[model samples]
Target chain A: MNIVVCLKQILDPLAPAREFRVDNEKKEAVRGAASLVTNIFCENAIETALQTKEKLGAAKITALTFGAADAEDSLRKALAMKADAATHVMNDGATNPDPLAVAQVLTAAIQKLGAFDLVLTGRESGDWGVGQTGALLAELLNTPYVGFVDSIESADGKLKLKRQTDNGFELVEATPPLVVSITNDEHNVPRIPKTRDVMMSVRTPITKFTLEDLGVDVATIRAGGDYYAVADLSIPVKDVQCEFVTGDSLEQKVEQLAQRILEVTRAL
Target chain B: MNNVIICLFASAGFDRATQGVAGAGRRLADALGGQLHAIMLGAFTATDEAALAAIADHVSVATELADYQPETCLAALTQLCQPLAPRAVLLSNDTYSQELAPRLAFRLGGSAVADGVELISHSEHLQVKRAVYGGKAVATIALKRNPAVVWLRARAFEPAAPRDVTANVEPAALTLTTNSATRIVERKSESAGEARLEDAQIIVSGGRGLGGPEPFEDLKALAATINAQVAASRAACDAGWCPPTWQVGQTGKKVAPGLYLAVAISGASQHLAGMSDSKVVAAINTDADAPIFKHCRFGIVEDYKKVVPLLREKLAAARQ
Candidate 1:
C-alpha cells in the first residue's frame, strides 16, 4: 500500500492572545515573535499514516508539504516518526493561499509523484481553519473523499475507517485511491521521535519541487481578484466589562451568582 | 430574478441552525432584490415544509436524498443549481455542509468560505467575515466568483420568521447517480435525551483548574439544575477528564449559547474562540487574574468547589 500524508507548518495556536497581531494591509497575521510548529491536526494525520503502515506491515508512507523552506522541519518530524520519504513543494508566492489554490498545487505535486493508493491531510489547518482543502483536493484529484476520519484499518483489500459525525461515529469502508481528512482522536496523538531518529531525519534526503517544476503559475495563484480576496482583517473589539459578584462569605457569593444566573436565563 | 439558494439538511430537520441559515439567505436575497429559494434534501417533516415555505419564495424538495451520501447529494445539488444561476448558495455549518460546501463550489466554478459569522452583500458580490487565528482576529473576505458558496456559524443569525403567505413548493429536478466508492458499514449514536452543547441556551463549562474528573460531576449537577449542557475546556478534555466530544475550543465545537458559565478555566485564546460568540459570559475561578474575566459579563473570584455546590443548591431551591 502507498499512503501519502500532507503536513502543514503554522504559527503555534497555543500562543498567548496578547501576542497575536495582524497586518491589515497585507491581510495576514503578523508573525513577529511567534514560533512555528507543525499543525496539531497534521501531526495527527502523520500519526494515522504511521499506524496504518504499522497495521498493513508492507505499506510505504510518504510525507508531503507545500510551504516555505521552514516547513522542512515538519517533514523532518514526520520522517523521524518513520515515514519512508518526504517531498517539499516550495511555496514562494502568497504566504497563505486559498483552499482552491492549495488543492491545485497539491494536485499537481501528487500527480508528479505518480500513483498513490490513498491521500491524507489534516481535517483543517490551525491557522485559517478553513477546513476545505481535503475536500477540494479530492475534487481536483477526481477521488472519493471522506472527512473527519479518526482511524483506518485494512479490510479485505479495502480500508475501513472510523468517521466522526456530529451525533457519534460511523464505520465506513472505501476502496483504494481515496482521499481522507483526519481529525484528532486519543488513539492518534502524534508520538515524539527518538533523539537518534531526529538526528537521522536531519540527514535524510528530501525531494524538492518549485511551482514552476509542477507547471503551476505563481502569478495566477497570487492574483487577488481571481478567486477571493481578503477585504479586511481586524481584531473584533469586545466591550464587555465584568461585574464581579462580591460577598464576604462563599455562601453569599454563591447566592448572588445564582440570582444573576436566574436573571440571565429568564431574559433568554 | 437573481435567486439566493439555501440548502437545508432534512436529516437535521429544520433545527435552529437550519432556520438561521434560511434567515441568512433571506437577508442576502433581500439585499440583492432577488427571490429566496430553499432546497430541502432528504425526507422532511410537514413542519419543515411549512417553515421553509414561510421564509423562502420557492421551495424544492429532493426526497430521493433521504440520507447524506456526499457524491449523490453533490450530483443532485449541482444539477439543481445549474439552471437557477443563484447569486449565492448558503448552508449551515455542520458536518455534512462542511464536507459539501467546497465540493459543490468546485463543481459550480465558485468560491467557498466556511464558518462565516457575518455576511455582507454588495450589488455585484458578497463578503464574509469569519474568525481566524483561533478567534483572536476576524477576516473579511470578498468573493470573486458567481454563486458564492458559504456556510455560516450556528446562532450567528436569527431564525427566519414565518410569513403569513406560503411559497410555491415543488419536487427538485435532479438526476442522481450513486456511483459512490465509499459506504457506511455501521453507525453508533451517542445516547440521546441529554441537551446538546450547541443547542443549549445555557452552558456550564469547566477547565484544567477543576483538578480532576470528579469535579466535572459537580459541574454537571449544576448544569442539570439549570437544564444547561456540560462542556469542558481543551485542557480538561486533553487530560481525559471528560469526553472529547464535550470539548469546546477552537479545534473543538464552536458554541454560541445565550449564556456561557465557565468554571476553573483560565480562558486560553483557543478556548475563547469557541465561546466568544456567547451572548452572556460568566466565570467562577480562584484566580481573579485569569483572562476569562476580561471577556465575561459577570465574574466571581473564588474556588469553584465552594461556589459550585452552593450555587447549585441555591438554583435548585429557586426553581422549586
Candidate 2:
C-alpha cells in the first residue's frame, strides 16, 4: 500500500490571542514572533497515515506539501516521524491562493506521483480553517472523499472509516484512490521523533516541484483568478465590556459572578 | 435566477440549526426580493415536510436519496438548481453541509464561502463576513458567480418561526447513479442525546486549568443548574481528559450562545475562535492574565475548583 499525506505549515495557532493581527491594507495576516509549525491537524493526519502503515506492515508513506520553500521544514518533520519520502510543491504563484487553486495544484502533484492507494489531509488548515481542499481535490481528481474522518481500517483496497458529525459518528466505506480529511483525536496524536532520526531526517534529500513542473500556469492559479473575492478585512470589535466580579474571597466571587450572569441574562 | 434555495438536512426531525438555516435563507431571499425554496434530501417525515412547508414558499424533497452522500446530493441539487438558476443556495454550517457546500458550488459553476456569520447585499453582489485567523478578525467576501453557495454559522440568525401559510410541495427531479463511489455503512452515536453545543442557549466550557477529567463532573453539575451545554478546549481534549466531541475551539464546533462561561481556560486564540461569537462571555481562571479575560465580558480571577461548585449552588439558589 502507498499513502500520500498532505501537510501545511501555518503560523502557530497556539500563540497568545494578542499576538495575532491582520494587515487590513495588505489583506493578509501580520507575521508574529510565533514560529511556523506544521498545522496540528495535519500532524494528526500524518499520524493517522503512520498508524495505517504500521497496521499494513508493507506500505510506503509520502509527506507532500505545497507552500513556500519554508514548507520543507514541515516535510522534514514528517520524515523524522518515519515517512518514506518528502515532496515539496513550491508555491510560485500568489502569496495566498484560495482553496480551489490549492486543490488544483495538489491534484497535479498527486497525478505526477503516479499511483497511490490513499490520500489524506487535515480536516482544515489552522490559518483559514476553510475545510475545502480535500473535497475539492476529490472532485478535480474524480475520486470519492470522506471528510472529518477520525478512524480508519483498511484491507484489500477497501477502507472502512468512522467519521465525526454534529450528531455523532458515522461508519462509512470507500475503495482505494480515495481522499480523506482527518481530524485530531486521541488515537492520532503525532509521535515525537528520536534525536537520531531527527538528525538523519534532516540529511535526507527532498523532492521539489514547481507549478510549471506540474503543468499548471501560475497566472490562472493565482489569488485574483478565482471566482471569490475578499472585499475587505477588519478586526472584529467587541462591544461588551468585562464586568469583573469584585470580591475579597473565592466564595464571594462565585456568588457575585452567578448573580451578575443571571441579572444580565434573566435566564432564571 | 433570483430564487434562493435552502438545502435542508433533516436528522431525527427539523432541529434548531435546521430552522436557523431556513431563517437565514429567507433573509437572503428577502434581500434579493426573490422567492425562497427548500430542497431536502434523505429521510424526512411528514411532520418535517409540513414544518418546512410552513416556512418556505416552495419545498422540494428528493425522495430517492438513501443517505446524505455528497455525490448524490450534488447530483440532485444540481438538477434542481440548473433549471431554477437560483441566485443563492444557503445551508447550515453542520458537518454534512460544510462538506457539500463547496462541491455543490463547483458543480454549479458558482462560488462558496463557509461559516459565514452575516450576509449583506450591496448593489448586485452578496457580501459575506466570516471569521479569519481564528476569530480575531473578520473578512467581508464577495462571490463573482451566480448561485453563490454558503454555509451560515449555526445560531448566527434566528430560526424562522413557522407561519400559517403552507408552501407548494414539489418533488425534485433527481438524476442519480447507483454506482456511487462512497456509501455510509452504519452510524453509531458517539455521545448519546446530550445537550448539543451548537443549539444550546448557554455554554459552559472547561480548559487545561481544570487539572483532570474528574473535575468535569463538577462542571457538569454546574451546567445542570443553568441548562448549559458542556464543552472543553483542545488542551483538555488532547490531554485525554475528555472526549473530543466536547472540544470547543478553532478545530471544534464554533458556538454562539446567550452566555458562555469559561472555567480554568487560559483563552488560547484557537479556543476563542469557537466561542468569541458568543453574545456574553465570562471567564473564571486562577491566572489573572489568562488570554480569555481580554475577550470575555466578565472575569472572576480565582481557582475554578472552588469557584465552580459555589457558582453552581448560587445559580441553583438564585433560580429558585
> Candidate 1 residues A31-56, lDDT tens each?
88889999999999999999998899
Quote each prediction's TM-score: 0.97, 0.94
Q: At residue B255, what lDDT does model 2 achieve?
A: 88
* Predictions in order: chain A TM-score: 0.97, 0.93
* A153-202: candidate 2 lDDT, tens digit per residue: 88567888889988578888788788999997778889999999999999
Compute the lDDT of residue B51 as modeled in candidate 1.
80
Instruction: Report the Cα lDDT for residue A178, model 1.
Output: 87
DockQ of 1: 0.78
Clashing pairs in 1: none
TM-score of 2: 0.94
Q: What is the lDDT of residue B221 in candidate 1?
A: 94
Please list the C-alpha lDDT of all candidates, in the order they appear.
0.88, 0.83
